[model samples]
Target: MAMLPVYILAGICLSYIILLLSLLYGWRNLKNNPRFVSPFETGFSIIIPFRNEQLHLPGLFDSLKNLKYPKNKFEILLINDSSEDDSEKLVQEFRKMHADLSIELLQNQRESISAKKDAIKVGIDKSRFEYIVTTDADCKVPENWLQGFDNYIESQDSDLIAAPVIFVEVHPEDPLFRKFDLIDFMSLQATTIGSFGLRKPFICNAANLCFKKKAFQVVGGYKQSGNYAGGDDVFLLQKFKEHKRKIDFVRSNNMIVTTSAQKDLRSFIQQRLRWAAKSAGYDDSFARFAALTVFLMNAALIIGLVLCLFDASYLQWLMIAFLIKFNLDFMLIYKAAVFFDRKASMRSYALSSIAYPLFSSGISLTSLFVGFKWKGRGYRK
Candidate 1:
């Protein structure tokens, strides 16, 4: 019946409105959080996991060398995941050059399918500090990154902290691919911060995540999460949530970790597919509902366009749907852009918006049947 599509469209619009309100509430809560800066007293163990990241290691080491925290209060643990490249040698060389820093190189003891989780566990097992922080080989940390966390933990009494991560334009003259990736990644980061505002935090990037060593041990330390290749951050967050542990999101410019965008479209799509695959493993009903609502909203727009081919009247509804979704999404992403201080990136939002529905729906469908390759390894749902 013609009314079926109308009803579905109504549902989609309502869902977007609910999502928008939730994000708005979350954004306000995030902004209201008083910025706290206290003396650095908590000792931290920073963990970097890698496989064939020889080229990126230099920049990471340079960033690590520039950290403003007291050298005695933190140690760097580089866990090599059996890299075929010179990643191990690079860490060793960097350690020798900075002998004054408490840096150590260790091999990833793989015992399951999730090599990254195994690598992180290995580092956590060897960590000597009270806190554990994880970042990627391709990421660069701010000088005040540790200081921000220290201040936050000291003030909030948090067991886990999720910080922001942004993608930097690799080329001075940005390509369309890079711009698209930036917008998409920003939307995710916005959702992350907003979810915390809503008090239903779900997603967090391991690239800038910190948690207490004792809390991790109490939560069983990724015993069953190793079944998935990804979600070292999100899955663990869920466990902490289940145990009613205290977690907070650190929303500060100095805490943001900058990472490189994928160089090519193939790599970009693969990365997204890997991320999407983790959704199948999410136990959080709110997260699942959010994801489904987003997918259906986008799918309706795509489907509405096709329906307009036969019935021109459907064009009116499609336009209304697009406008509603566009305005809501823009509001949320704009708040995130302000926080990241990359409002100039919004120039690409219009183009990225047009393409996102197709891209997201495609990734969702592909994730159902196709396995994705990450760091020379393949995984399936």
Candidate 2:
């Protein structure tokens, strides 16, 4: 009985220290990547893939109309990913409404299980410009989105550029569980951009990622990550990393693309699990290290929870366990929120701290057992 309490406390203490170190690492990167204010000027083909995205296009159209870049310098390419819905017609209708917007609607020819990747591949075929800026149909881009990309591309020689992606909460009354999920995603985006600033980092989001048309051809794009369900971001990131090619992370707030948070818990888990499954195939050591850090942090929390059940001696230990967990996570998420400009979500950090470890572990485990389904297709890891 005496040894039980000591063991639990020791485990929790160890977990806290690791998390604090991770947080410190994250905070240091945040400090290094101060925001830039200049506008982007590169002529780009903004390629967007959609499937049943009718609900979100109004906001996207508004953003498109609102962009500050010269209307002629950018063209919008919307690839209909074989949606049964009237997604194509909607884009066409919008095009007719705004004759000067330079919008083109293309049909997504299905070549694989993942509709998104194939849609992107098709978009590449249809693009007439040298530079490509890819964003999700659901995202609400900043007015200066293309201008930021153009400015950065001209000033920098990098073939690939990854931008910041942040989540916006539409429903204020959202449950803590949903908000909990958002906090985790915020830390991820923070680390992704920070890694670029820190040097030797491997993290990116497809929602707001961009690259030259030549870069995709050089790396072979989704060809490397085709067997898997997701990772249009990381797999391409690895290819760029291999060439020792220059890929810059656009940290400016103007470059930030706001996307919607998952509306419910079930869809959220499935989405995360699909992401975790790709970790097994990741070739980059930096991405693997980041993955390992998250895994170990969650593993430590799980062990502590398991001990709390039967060990009466865990009474004092549980108190220490949770305190260490909460504080360590707070440091990282706080920096993330500040960088992403969503500091209000930090209030959700408490529940996120408790749920994140288990949520991560569950996704990892689920990925191992069952193949996940997305857009009416199933894929095996």
Candidate 3:
């Protein structure tokens, strides 16, 4: 029993030290914030794929109205993924309401298990510009989002770019969840951006990611891994990383996309499980290593907790383990929060920290089952 706790303790310690070192390495690569979210004179076709987005359209339209870019320079093409709801009608409503901007509704032609990827592919095929940016239909985008992408593209000689996604809700409304969970998420976001700064990044969200049309085609356009119900972002990112280390992490708050929070715990778990399931098939070595380290750290912590229930000696070591985890996580998240301009909701972070490890550990195990329900559809890996 004692040996078990010691083993787990060592794993957490080692992982924390590595994360600390990586965070420092990332801090040095800071550059001027590229304003891709703004309305530059350059033309762009923003691709937003949707199945049922009726509930989110109000917020979406509100954000669309606030975009700082010129209406003539960029257009919106919303892909309707056979939504049973009135998503197409909603788009029509928007078009009628705002006649100044180009807004077109494209029906997604179904081809594979990855419906979202197919929608994006269809959008890519229809885009008019060399720069293709993808965001979710349910997100609230920053006004200057396009300007950041444009500036970054002009400044950097890169093809693939990863942008940050922030949570829009101030409070999750959940009962007594620590702010640490939110903090941890921000830290992970920072680490992702930081890794790009260090020129070894492997994390990105499709909620605000952009790519050059040429590089996306050069990598064969997700055909290699389109079967995955998830990973439209990560698999494509691996291709970018492999082809060139020129992958950039977009850090400007203007380039960020703010997404709504999950409605409840069940939704949160399923969402996280979907993310964890993709870890098994990642192509990037650095990504795999990072995932493995996080897994080991969390898994070990859970094991140590079980051991502590029987062996009293592990109690002190537990405190040390938590302190290391908290301090390191806090440092990374603090930097990221500063960049995102989001103050940490520490109440959620502290409780979320305790729940996050167990939550991640459980989802990692559940992903081995290979099939899950998403949006009332069955997805199999």
Candidate 4:
């Protein structure tokens, strides 16, 4: 019976190792092979929802101006979710400057807990095109963003397409915590792609998502999980899966969207808590299983380290166990880093790995018992 703790630790680590292996296999299976380019035939209604995002609005507007897609094929709908700052003024100025482009600014009518969802619903209602593409106000789209979606739509019969999102590049002289944030986010992007490759796509980001307006209406337009403020992308993805609508992930790097990371630890924690709080609304069993397994593995590692301090005998075994998980994590994240062309960020991976168990466990626990703040508002699961 004295060996029971070791057995339990092995079980937890083994389960996680298997999960990682499957994700690695899935990642390998999902490839972006260069192919003959298709004509940009699908028209897109670009929907952007914002609160107080005056600082990031200019970057988005600049990116929009640089898009290579035909101006007549896409329209921009900027939904203002009660911004108190000069965000509205920025959008108005952009509209006046680019009167040749189809752009409209609309106010968000809050009918649900998720203000972003309400804003998106309003945009979809006003959209003129058949395809609804969404990105956050803080994100900068690539020049081929719409063209990439059009190519994918013309080739695939998918109803929803999820593309990648990455953080702005981190310089070597930047703070170590910033690299940590980039790696953490890249892991999420990797998992997203891997899950799609495995044909169990569970999570997606609103920051780079495209779907049919008919699919949105068919799924009842977030009415199923409208109570949650944070899962505007994930819950909608779950709904698509339930209704058997075809979903695919765009594998091209040119399709990526760039966004900023939280600057400080306090804001980072709050952001993660807000994300964790939305897990309660996830009906996808694979998503829940993946979440629980990751949490348990991290929590187990923390407990094992604590036990090592009390008993020296646990040190060697714990180190071996830690190395096993560490190598697996490195493989997954390193692949993602290469895909995003941010392998330089991997220099901080060792330090970040040592800190992650504690950080993840704390966030998971805090999210369950405590509320988190987003966009100047507080939320609970």
Candidate 5:
């Protein structure tokens, strides 16, 4: 009976280790060797949803201007979700300044609780292209962004494709907070590709997603997930999976999109809470299992540490568990860092590892009961 806690602690650590190992295998196996395709053919509708993003719009606008794909092959659709800022004016100016590029500014028709989902659906309805791509106003796409998707579409009969998103390269001189955010985000990116490599993708970022407009329609769009305020990407991914639509990950670094990290801790916590609130809507067994395992592993680590203070024997068990999680986590994130070209960010890994349990566990627990604010709106789970 005294060893019961030891057994449970070991069990949780083992489960976490197994999960990371499988993901590592998957991340290694997934590859994208860009095919030399002549004359780009796939037409795309780039959908961006915004609310009070005037500060970030210019970067995205500049990136859009630098795209290597044919202007006629893709049209930009910016959906305004009650932006009380100059976001709308900036888009209108960009459109007028670059009349050669196809850009449309439209107001979001709020038919559902999820404003971003509704914004995306509105863009899809107005899009003249067969493929719909979604990204945030704050994200800057690489010049080859659209081209990469085009080439992938030409090579595979994929119904939906998810690419990569990373924060702009963080220098060692930068604040530790930014470095912490980068590594944390990279972990997610690693998990994303790893899951894809396993052929059971459960998470994708809307900031860098592409899908067939027809497939979205067939999946009935985000209507089922409308009650939630977020998950415009995840819920759609679930619907596509249920219908057995072919989904894939774009595994090229050149195709990555870059977005800025949160400016402060308060904003960062809010962002995490918004992300966690949507987990209640996840129906994918693997997603639920993955979320549960991660949460329990973090929670157990914290609990084990507390137990060690009360009983000296518990310290040994906690060390073994922490070592198992630490090494495996570093292995996964290291691979992801190399892929995203942000290996410098790993310098903070040691400290971040110590802080992650508390951070992740708190966010998971708080999200279950607390309401969070995002894009100037409040949401409760």
Candidate 6:
């Protein structure tokens, strides 16, 4: 029985090593293969779904105005998901100022529990272009965002494209909480890109995801997946994958989208809980395995710490476990940080690593039983 813990620890270490290798493999594959931009000919319908985003709408509008793509080639469809704030008014004001742009504001026709999915469906139904690109109202895209996507679409015969999204640095004097969010988010982005490299793509943020209108129709446009409030992006990706469609990750720097991190710990936890809640509904076996592996690895670390209190001799094993996990995690995240140009955030990695096991384990447990609030709404799993 004494050897049981040792065996479990060995298993986790082996799992971490395999995961690390997978991420490294994915990163190297991505770096070696370069995507070149070609003539922009694909027309896009940009979907911006919102609920009480009055504070961040201006940044998105500014980015939209600065888009380098031809105004006639793409249109913006702003879907209002029953916001009590002045989000509608702000969009109206922005629309008046940019008359040359083909922008329209529409109300979300809620048909299910997930209003965001419903909003996206409405936007797709109203979209006139061949391609559908979805982004969050709180995000800002690069000036060449559409052009990059256009080039990729025109260059390849892909049905869905997953691009990168990062957290915007507020200031140099950002707090530890913000730094924690940055590192945590980068790890997710790294996993996303790495999963694609492994040819087992499971995660993609809707903040910068694009798909074809016909593909969306073929998958029934979130008809069944709308039962959950979250996963509007990942669930749709799974649908595309189920059909064996050509889905590629756009790793170009010019295609990266940026959004602000949650300001406070409560909101951050809530956000993570919302994200974790979607795990139960994932149909992809690789995604479930990856998520379970990560959760168990963190849980084992926390358990090892508790076992140390019973026997001081257990401390050695705990240290080994932490070192293995830490080094492997840092390697994957470092590759991601370099790609995202946020290597400076690694300063807080040591401290964040200590706190992450507990945070992740707690979120994983809490999400199974408790509900979470998002965008001024409460949801129960």
TM-score on alpha carbons, each prediction: 0.97, 0.89, 0.92, 0.98, 0.98, 0.97
Q: Write the per-residue lDDT of candidate 3 for residues 82-107, one digit (tens) a residue.
A: 89998778889999999998888898
Off by over 4 Å in 6: 32-36, 170-172
List pairs with backbone clashes in candidate 1: none
**How many residue pairs clash in each candidate at the backbone level?**
0, 6, 28, 0, 0, 0
lDDT digits (tens) for residues 90-145 of candidate 4: 99999999999999999999898889899999999999999999999999999989
Model 1: per-residue Cα lDDT over 97-184, one tens digit each? 9999999999999898899999999999899999999999999999989888898888888999999999985343867888889989
Displacement of residue 217 (Cα, Å) in model 5 is 0.4
Candidate 3 residue runs with Cα over 4 Å from true position: 1-8, 32-41, 172-181
**How high is the lDDT of residue 130 in model 1?**
98
TM-score, cand. 3 vs. native: 0.92
Q: How many collisions between residues are there in candidate 4?
A: 0
Candidate 2 wrong stretches, greater than 4 Å: 1-23, 30-41, 170-172, 314-322
Over 102-155, each residue of candidate 5 has an lDDT whose tens digit, in order, gives: 999998998978888889988999999999999999999998888888888888
Off by over 4 Å in 1: 32-36, 170-172
Pairs that collide in candidate 4 are none
Candidate 5 stretches with Cα past 4 Å from truth are 35-38
- TM-score, predicted candidate 5 vs. hidden true structure: 0.98
Q: lDDT of each prediction vs. the true structure?
A: 0.90, 0.76, 0.77, 0.90, 0.91, 0.89
How far residue 231's Cα lies from its native spot in candidate 4, in Å, is 0.9
Write candidate 2's Cα lDDT for 1-381 as tens digits.
667646645754675575457546644764333334555556788889888888888888888888887887888999887777777778988999999888988887877767788888888888888888889988999987776777677778768888888888524588776787778888787667557656755778989888998888987778867777688888888888887778887777777899877757766767787888888888877666667656765676677567768775565666676677677667767877887777888876776677777878778878888877665556776
